[model samples]
Target: MKDEAFDPVRKLVAPGTTVIWRNTGSADHVVDSVQFHDTADQWQFRTQTLRSGDSVVYAFDQEGIYEYYCGLQGEEMCGVILVGDVSLSNSLPCE
Candidate 1:
């Protein structure tokens, strides 16, 4: 994830899968799990400000849609993770 974009922007994964975001930009950034209209209190998770080369990982243990964005950039830098029924083998469909 960067200042104004998330690579791939959207992802689909199995429950219990772990996702990672690596900061490659010069500025700081954050991964916030909340929609644009919701209050800060409604967010499920938020990462600390990540400087260049920093990385964050999260596990999706439930089936549903997870909306996330860079709190600093708001809607301009956002993404979604779609967690659905998948094999326990933990391999992504593309693999």
Candidate 2:
């Protein structure tokens, strides 16, 4: 992760794979699932503020699109994770 954005901005992973977000910037950051907007109490993925060198890991158990953003940076620092079949290579197009 950079100071203002995630390195790839988009990622594709197989179901049950573990995803890790490492904070490589000088500031603090947070990872919040976008699908939990209305049901604030039911968020499946949320991370505590992570300073430089800190990291968070999450395992994607279902096949679907997961959207997330840095709670501190809002839209300026966001990314998408697509959990699907592992047979498809990383170069495969999204959608």
Candidate 3:
């Protein structure tokens, strides 16, 4: 995480991959998934307050798009993780 933004705003990973996010900026950050659409699973992931130098990790077990933003920041500071071969059609519009 960086000031008012998420570095590598988009990431592509295989299902079963473990992703890590490290806070390399000065501000505190909280990474959390957004429920962009209705799903039976209603899956969500979040990190504890991430101070500078802190890091968080998540495992991607399903094949789909995961959109997230900084709770301390806002949607403007957002990112997406594309698992498997998911289409951008299911993703939020790019800024």
Give stretches of model 1 more than 4 Å off: 36-43, 85-95
Alpha carbon deviation, residue 15, candidate 2 (Å) = 0.7
Q: Candidate 2: TM-score?
A: 0.78
Residue-pair clashes per prediction, in order, are 0, 0, 0
Query: What number of backbone clashes does candidate 2 have, counting pairs of residues 3 or more apart or in separate chains?
Result: 0
Candidate 2 lDDT, tens digit per residue, 15-92?
A: 899999999989889988774233221336789998999998998888877777888888668777777842222321
Cα lDDT of candidate 2 equals 0.72
**Which residue pairs does candidate 2 place in steric collision?**
none
Question: Between the candidate structures 1 and 2, which one is better when assessed by TM-score?
Answer: 2
Point out the worst 10-residue segment of candidate 1 by lDDT.
86-95
RMSD of 2: 6.2
**Cα lDDT over the full model 1:** 0.72
Model 2 segments beyond 4 Å from truth? 36-43, 85-95
